[model samples]
Target: IELAEVVREVTKAENKPFKPMYDWGDRVEDKIFSVANKIYGAEAVDYTATAKKDLARIYELGFDKLPVCIAKTHKSLSDNPHLLGRPKDFLVTVREIIINSGAGFLVPLTGDIIRMPGLPAVPRATVIDIDDDGNIVGLE
Candidate 1:
């Protein structure tokens, strides 16, 4: 069966809805601060020199109104991976801001987090099948 069909058969979802955490229309910097504070329990936000420059460029480009997606550590609520659980009284230092205008969102790189682009599992070369006559099937 297909994945969706299997999911439907295995679990009965209530289709319950939850409200959005913050309004997407809010300022990009405000959104970053809000996420750092509300979700991670950060006391304050400190932007690095590079991050400040990045933010300035973003604002100058009129991208300050864009939504923000903070890249932080997954091991903890805070930026540091060592601080597990709901950490509080910590400062979130934004290292840099990456503008993805096409995707319609700004990504703020927090702490020492490295931004890794999502890649597909199957390589295109693996799909290139050949028959006994040596005719390629998926070269395109």
Candidate 2:
């Protein structure tokens, strides 16, 4: 998607105006990449490799077979961590799986999931201080 955006920008600057190039069609890849960027660096290791390591580690712990719980964004293949800024392409892959008995769900520890959350402009915290004389004052 970033590549496509670049192509579009280049075309516009050159007075060509290309429709834009998309591998998976539309801007899905771009959106996914954006999310991953927010969670991890653009050059972070592949998710598949991470997943495989997790599976091996879990198996070594004496856990039997379990369901697979993908931690990536269900909306897209990539995780959602980056903000609105453009993101680079980072391939994602799965490695292993484990069952979470406590939660009654399969915990498939994938490479990683970068979750960038939205915050309120105004924080909901107030600071107050009191002196030995019992004089209270507001803190900023």
Best lDDT goes to which candidate? Answer: 1
Candidate 1, position 57, lDDT: 96
Model 1 regions lying over 4 Å from their true place? 1-25, 118-123, 126-140
Model 2 / residue 62 / CA error / Å: 3.0
- Residues 22-79, candidate 1: write the lDDT tens digits: 7777766678888888888999999999999998899899988888888898888888
lDDT of each: 0.85, 0.48
Residue 7: error of model 1 in Å? 18
Worst 10 residues of 2 by lDDT: 20-29
- TM-score for each prediction? 0.70, 0.30
Assess candidate 2 and give its TM-score to the true structure. 0.30
